[model samples]
Target: MTDVSRKGSLSFLNPFKTRSGSRSSSRASSVVDFKIGDDARKSSISTATIKETNSSGRTSRAGSAKNSLEYTRSSRQGSTLATTGEDGWDRDAQTGERKDHTDLLHSLVDESTAESLADKAQAMFIGIPAKPAADLFSRFPEGVWRRIVEFLGPADKASLAFSCKPFRTLLGTRSWTDLNSPQNRDAKFDFLGRLDEQLPNHLLCFQCGIYHVRTQKGQEVLRPTNVSNPIFNCPNVFNLENKVARHRITVGRALPFPFVQLILRGQKYSPEHGIPIDSMSRRYKDRDGEWTHQTRYVVVNGHLLMRVISSAFATPALPPAGLRRLLYSPSDNFNPYFSVCAHWRDGNLMPAVKCALSHIPKPPEGSGIAGTSAKVQYHFHRPHPIITLCSECRPMRRCPECPTEYLIEMRVQEDRSDPDPRKLFKHAVVVTRWSDLGDGSSPKSLEWAACNGEAEYDSFTALGKRAISGTFESQFTVDQIPGQKMVSMNPNKIKLGEKGHDWY
Candidate 1:
């Protein structure tokens, strides 16, 4: 029976207590009770109710947090939902204040996604105490758990077993045992990668498939590919057959994988694990060529984005032989001197560069873009300082196979070393490559594998309409290129590399 008190006073619902002040049936009912001055206070849970709008256009109250709301004269008029405020939160019915203490996961992730389940799973770990969680885990049969884990991968199985002592006991040591197998090296590497937060003194080596002591640690510096620069001493370092993970930047420059790992590890965890991503940025001139390259990196959604701007001073109206001499490297299988992906030779990349070189404006009243008449060479009356490239080379080019995008352009910059004053400023062909290098998870990752030409990936399909160049460029400057068109580097979907003659 419900015993009601005056307004703003306490009420009680005691099913065991009779209205005649006598003992009744011994059935339990929720809430409080007090009998006269006997101090007969009892404790109970207080639950709030929230209205959930379901797919059927019906509003049903569900038990929730601490604050309670009672709907009065409410009807499902339009959509059984109220409009959220500008701040993306529901407001108080009368106060107009935002209800920020709501289910925030809805805003961050869709309920149907795996990320939402991960959040829920994390809550399961944090919600219960160790003893209680252990007790709860004891309720499930070990065989059932084994059956459930049968669908899990090696890394996932190890993760589950490693989460808690109860899980370890329940799952046994088979997952850990399996990780030690030679066939499960990838799985073990992936499992070890998860422990990155706890292991700052060591770095994962892809070739060796183990964590090595960081000998250089924070003092690590990127060096030339041929140089003996080791972040950590590995037995595989001296093995000629086992090369570490690295990407070729220019003809002579290469970016080691450990630096990428460091940059991403710092970004993913803390500075103690690695170094700041900005430390990876570099600007260097090739010793053998006139090409100068500047590389900058950005982290977007856990993926490493790289931008390399390679520029070379070009003479106007070059011959075909001079063009090949300027662009191609004989030592590197006729590859471009500028930064390019493994799929560079298959497309119109070389032809487009040749096209851009042809657009280098020749001085009207001079011998060339870099030279002038002997009399006019001393001062003034030079070519216009703007190098306007045609539509062929102006737009950005995205590789169809990998997540690399290229933009080729011509710019007029002052040639400080020029002897003549009139021809001091010359045209330079600038090739800017923006690439998505995947997460620093592993070498077998899609973007990384595709970048090295070891795996197949459709850049357009994976990246959609968004441009990596646009993302990389937006970080440094506000002066973004407007109406920038992006076309595939390989439009015909050709796969021939050195076998193709069009690369000439």
Candidate 2:
């Protein structure tokens, strides 16, 4: 009643086929046919399983290029999961090796400080192409890229050069070679047509007084002074020359205030009346009746020092007009100060902006108040910031080893209350910064510091003979050594004695 016939027929088909041989002959025959069909189906499934495994293995091998660990481990982990049809495509691989690989990559990315990497990450997030900067730069034509770099200044060129190899090479090319090179520096100075063109931006050397302009690559470079380029013996040395003489600019030292004050006092009094200052002096009169004499005044370490070199006064005439006349004029000889002469000779035109003082001279007593002297009042000109040579000494001996030749000995002497006209020009040179003469036009009149007493026309007219002004006048006159001198001069030697033989 419960389908006993159907149950008996299905029993013959079981792997452990039911042993019902006597049950029915038809059932026996049916069991043999079913066995043949089941065997065929089992064989087909086994073949398909083998094919699927091989195909998955091949797929894993191919994908190992990108995600090698995942592919290899999935294969070794077994085909049970695949055959069983589980979703394990993105499953993690064996822990140790996989973790190490991930950590190394992460550390590498974190270590770099380049903004480009961060930019690339941002680009990745924003769906932009994260092409490398070097690659992008490489895409441009070399000439075009070079042209872009040409416009950058000293600082910008440095930053760009460090960015990539191409930029560095571009800078090394002739267009941007080392700025400190002799050729480059000479060209730069010549092209600008003025030495002071780059002065404001340059750094003043602490060892020498040269204001060094930095290279385009942002390097503080100096042209090496070898035997071939024997301009100055030391690279640190900067030579400043003028009509007066070559002044070796060394590190400026602080001058004593009392000493400077003494110099100022002497300069304030004229040598003829009181004691004429030996250094060159100029007198200027304004539209009003006031007289002013311009000389070198330096304020160093907040102390005022009056420094006077042996310079000659200029004959009263119209000041030089135009840049050429002002720079190269032979008659421009009012260089009592070193700084003033240096600047004037270097073609700086700032001091040339002179205006006559406001105080015009009133006629002296007698002759119904008529101006007695032809040049009653002096016309004052503003002094230059940079000083040059005031006068050239007679050519003397030069140093044999060095390019130096002794021109003239400039004396720096100290005078304290012992009034003697014979003992002057006997001290060390003390250079300092010049005080600013505000635009050459001041409401107040400039006072004649060295010639304050009754002015003597004869002493004023003397070019190089007024010797009582400086700290010491003719007490000691030392001569500079020539570069080619075989031997040094000894004052103690030479048996020639004074005619009177006055040793005492």
Candidate 3:
């Protein structure tokens, strides 16, 4: 509708429509000109023309009616009109009171740069400190930061000092000096290991506590134990007295500490820093004994886990001497061809395998001797190919000295080399060992050392009821292997090595 705004100027007043879809006579409200942009939340609607008419219908103050903009809304009870002037003053036109001041955080950014409510809420919930809008850390004295640095370990202290130049200046170079000391070599290794992500082309040499250039880089491949496969040209590699760290995987396979480092680095950080744990897996056959081995790995709780399946066919109804040759590598260290913990001889591991092997069903042999006819006829009855062990050997066996678990199973597999079609399949003894190789942090790690028979370890107290076998197998096979029975290799808590007759 039309109305005399002020100074006899004709202005358009927006009509208030009722529910009946018709304009209704509205209450007399003061006119406030506001340049309302499309976004009312961010526009400077208050900074516009302001005019008030008294009860006598006389204009108290007025601006250029030809250029001033006007806006209208349904005025409700307890609602004051928004008004501002050319001077950009924020105040309530009705109460004539100034607007409240914005706080330090809000004042930094104007409405144009203001963060959305969702972004602000996310920042608050995530505890991300607002960008250095102020230098709060500078208020603290060097002595206070030094005290904080003293409480941290060598690695953490170095990390804090290396975080930023201000921190480096405050914490001083003492942390770096402490990390360089020989006594804190492990801490130095830990600190260097953290930089694996940043130094993808380099690998942390734990022995030297430095990042050596990755000589092989992406071309790194796991070779046999005897093969010289060096991922990095470390000074400690050829030092006979100071041997590079390694763990025995099987008879001819050794997992170098560098591979373990790279594997875990890939898992913990990025693929460029190290190789994938799946790449470390392998399947190979032993030159002797016709034993086949398949190795797989899994990372859990930051520790590298290994599972090796070694299977070889056993002649049915073999003698004790024959069982010895099948189980032990007499030509080598006399250790089992299958993967085993260092303390295998000190416990019932060998005895348990012998028991499992004895359960194999013996095939009947009928070669009749010539009685009166002087002719010979041969007949042999084949036994059931599938063999299942008794309750004693079937359960999973854990090494009390280390984080290693073993499960022996008998499966009838086709003997591809067997020429006779009738004897194509045979019962094979499969020994699967699951072990924890530690976190690849250092060479002297308890699990790694205990696995190599260098350090003492108590697997029961450390591992509790959770079996490594179950943890690793659950990654791929969806609980196909049951680990209900986990007993110590040394139930009697014995400590006899090769001196004991049972192991042999």
Please, what is the whole-model Cα lDDT of each candidate in the order they appear?
Answer: 0.77, 0.31, 0.75
Off by over 4 Å in 2: 1-144, 150-166, 170-183, 186-504
Instruction: Return model 2's CA RMSD, one decimal.
Output: 35.7
- For all predicted structures, in order, the TM-scores are 0.72, 0.19, 0.69
The best candidate by lDDT is 1
Model 3, 193-231: lDDT tens per residue?
A: 677678888987776777789888877899987788878
Highest TM-score scorer? 1
| TM-score of candidate 2 on Cα atoms, chains taken together | 0.19
Error of 1 at 144 (Å): 2.9
Score candidate 1 by TM-score against the native. Answer: 0.72
Deviating ranges (above 4 Å) for candidate 1: 1-115, 120-128, 164-171, 363-383
Could you give candidate 1's per-residue lDDT for residues 1-504 as a string of tens digits? Answer: 234445215323533332222122111111221211233433211121011112222222332111122122243332345553266766665557766655666755664554666787887889655565577677888788778888999999999999888878877899899998999998999899998889999999988777899998888888887689989989998787988888888897888788889989888888989988878889898787788889889999899998899999999788988998899888776778999999998889888899988976564444565455543654466456676777887877899999998888888888898899977878899898988988989988999889999998999998999888777776776356434699989899987876898788
* Residue 41's lDDT in candidate 1: 34
